[model samples]
Target: MFIGAVPKEVVGQVLATVPFDAWGNVYVGCSGSFRFDRAVKMRHPECRVYSNDVSLLTCSIGALAMGREFPVKFKGALAFVEPAIDGLDFRGRVAAVMVAAAMGNFTGKNEYAQVHFRHYREHFRTFVDQALPKLDALVAEIKIEEFYAGDFLEQADRAENSGGGMACFAPTYKGGYERIYKLVNENVEWPAPKYGIWNPDSLPALIVSLEERHIPYCVISDQLLADRTPTTEWRGSNKPVYTYSSNQAASLRRRLPNEVPFKYTPVEPAAITAESKVSMCVVDSKRMTYLKNVYLTKGIEHTTGQINCLVLIDGALAGGFIFAQTRFGDKTRELYMLSDFAIARERRLSKLIPMIATCREVIQPINRRLLIKVEYIVTTAFTTKPVSMKYRGIFELDKRTADHLQYQSAVRNQSIQDVFHEWLRKYAGQGGKPDRQGQAARAEAAGEECALHDAAGV
Candidate 1:
């Protein structure tokens, strides 16, 4: 019910459109500030109101402000009080359950530092002390069955099964402040009962689960409504809202099959060859367009130099590596940095080593007229330790800094060449021949190498 920053008129419009009946019950989860709860109660004076929150201090303040009896002990209870009236009649009994921005603030230790926790606790105390006394009339007008102190998802699960009504949830959207916090933090385990909006996948998973459970639901967001495609007509600011109903639940159960499809397709290993050809050539803008679509991370805007090399396996585009002039320091005088690189997900790691090694051949000739006589290729690995170690093995580890693991380009291309030679030896031992197709690819690779050497007068 915390209507932070939203105009009162917008709140009124949203409350007016909620699918509810007179004298029904309404439940508000994560009822911070309880402003929206008060507004809802005022709109439907006869309806019994129930609220649940994790903080006892906030709940106590809410009780005092509204002139309601505060619970003596709060032990993560799912529901504050039972519905004043309950029966098999699911439609008109329970009105609309509104969950407004009810995501947990406790992301983890890395992001939720000590200072943040201190500030939050101090702010809560100050706000409650100043605001609780002024809300007496707002609290007294509506009957609150109980204020449960616990996780929102647990309460929501209970509410969903306790007969059907319109359930509305406005969770913190993905890619918001919370997501940024999670991304910045390291060694953090998000505590659960994690609901939709906890992670990017959680919301979709929640919807799929609801569909499987026969809980009909639709996602609503201000962006979605502003685009003029709402699941249900509503009057309010285009704030994103997700609603599920018993009727939709029934339909979803009927439409979806019992089993869910497997989430991923198995990738077949790439064939190894004694004459497996990897040729690197400067890519045109058109090819760059195609690479951007397939590269795992980074787009053209992040890249800085013209020396973008396309890696072709035999004759198809298999991978790419882009180099940029160093913009960080005087290092530009001696380095051509590897800005972005990725192999197709379907490609094998055996192929990756050789493909990466090809950068050595590609870089040498390009440096002939380049601003800097490229002495070293540098890059940072920002992934987990194991993955960073893998990168370090391929590109010799230079140093471990606070922000990233830095790697120096190998002195010789021998690491990649050794891997390729080993694979070729195995292939030859297995009686594989250098066939016409393989020979043609090898010839093409040799020709490209000759062209680079010729251009560099090497």
Candidate 2:
């Protein structure tokens, strides 16, 4: 331990006892992430999507990593989503946010913060004298509340409150009880937000507290990520100290409007680029409904994307690929059918690969920041209760194997243009076979449908 580093477990127990949290979820503020970086994606496989858009890294390089000459159509954005309600089993769905520099304290207090309070104080009066405390105090209060409402309340309420009973938090010895009491009582407000090199003692306490409350949180500490460099500019009087792409949903706007009327204007987070996508699926007509999910999973399996979407081409695919109607902000997205075909295993061979290769052609490649080779990565698939899970990881596709199918300019001179045109044809033609439930719900929102028709002998 350094001259003044305290045991993290002691502090974690103290904070846990205070019961900080809103519904037992640790809400963390953070700096944005460069791209996919985590165990979740590495361990699961369904997240793979073939993006015909700007790569997350090396944004300027274009889709170079997806080097090819197939008919590539560009998708402005990609998105992956899961049901928010009971998305995973109780123990699996616990969402933990760790705010690091820029979002969480970049000081010793926040275990993941890389800089200390002293380093932060070097900048100005705002951090050390004011902002830091407000931030920390808010965290403390929230942590306590999470315990009361989500942890303890759930314990006394139901068995399904995300492991909210005695088992998650049975017993543990806290050694520095007297010491933590002393630290908590210290009225010594930092001269500035302590900004020396960050210390990691804070996370242990948060983890400890979470155990006590039966709340599950994943650690996303700044000290534990790729982008960690101490700079005063990222910090400010009001902005969070850090930000990450995953936490963007919450961090971008620290506060939201309340149900009650307020005197001041209540602003909302800036709208994100909602994804507009489509997929083509081939299935045995007799089993369409039963095998639809499996077919959809297959498209995701074969594509290289951050998000995947599919359009089923039964006998209905007379034109091309069709895009269902949806509007994102002022931008209207179009869907097209790049190819047309019948339902067969051979179709997967001739159609699926060519279709995927086409999408790969148009997208720019990733080159900057922490670069990772995509060729070796594979998505892991597993199912645990509420939702079938998918994540990303490293795997290999051997080009030297006799099974490897070589392509002609990435699939017989097929270009991104071919892909997009096909997609547009399908999207503009007609919507998918009637979605009874979805139709009933969208009855209120004004919506339009598009379709495409194109056919060739198999």
Candidate 3:
């Protein structure tokens, strides 16, 4: 059901500007429609084109489009693909790798009906069984050397290291929803929902990783914003194609070599003494949203009864936690769920205990006014820690939410209180000395006396 084809204009731009040399291999990752693969084959018949994908259905489609025989068995497709690529001779050839990554999960119309994991697994297995042999034979006959079936990042790394070639990534765009809807309106039957969209933020991380590894690459995306525009002239005429090449290809690489992956030094536990004042206060929604976007993976979803708390160290935003009303089956006696709880990566380990203590303290007063019982706190393992056997009373796994194991902790119980008090002692120790108000008062009095003396002298 995923949209397989990239726009022809985009493909043309890629074909026109991509720095592929004669006798070079074009390695395509997530080659959905094989549009780029076929184009490369026609343009440079002498050069080999290699494609990689994780999905068997997609691989089969790619094979069919390339006029290659489908693989008979799916089980050994992975076994054959990896070895074949590893065996290829990349010496003295211009290898251009294209990756059309499948990075999103789709919600099919039959998703609710397809309840069991085994059912989905078996359904996919059947297609793999049918497609593997044909795909294997297709790879053998065509100029394309291999069809890798695994993680795109891993394969990309391999292609960069072994082939030392130019890499192209055709990630999904923001306007993809509209395109998919249009396709559906035209009765162009695609899967119910396409999951993968190229997030602009993800590009910098990828660029940083490639740069760190010294891999020469280019991103062929319409969705990439103008900020990432290379200094060189864009070659494509039809589509507004933005290309970022390595320093070897263009000057953009030289301008900003270390643009992303923020630098930070890890804070030591001993650095935060007992007297260190850890201030917790309510933060604005805007600040909470900013932190969530930067730190949390999925970002924040505004919900009812949501409270955002910021943990400040020396008046600087060190960390934060978010609490929202729980949605666990009908028992709504003012229960809450904790989520988007995080500290700056640099201060994670050292600040964890303090962050938890701060969260507990901040939530206590908020609960008092609403007469909120806070019977139990339910949080997913994706966002919080796992429910270990040692803390049975404090937390337990709720299996009803099957997709992600939800961990629930009873907040009203003595066990959780004891745990929090113990952590508070272990992390935040005794209080620091009170403010110097007495000294300030005396100074003010002396100043008044000086003013009177000055008046009498006058």
lDDT of 1 by residue, 206-226 (tens): 332232222223332333322
Cα lDDT tens digits, model 2, 114-140, are 454334324323332343444333322
- Best-first order by TM-score: 3, 1, 2
lDDT of 3: 0.42
* Number of the candidate with higher TM-score, 1 or 2: 1
Model 2 residue runs over 4 Å out of place are: 1-309, 313-445, 452-458
lDDT of 1: 0.39
Descending-lDDT candidate ranking = 3, 1, 2
Q: What is the lDDT of residue 307 in candidate 2?
A: 17
Q: What number of clashing residue pairs does each candidate have, in the order they appear?
A: 8, 103, 17
| Residue 275 displacement in candidate 3 (angstroms) | 5.8
Residue ranges of candidate 3 with Cα displaced over 4 Å = 1-3, 6-53, 57-277, 293-305, 328-334, 347-360, 381-396, 400-403, 412-458
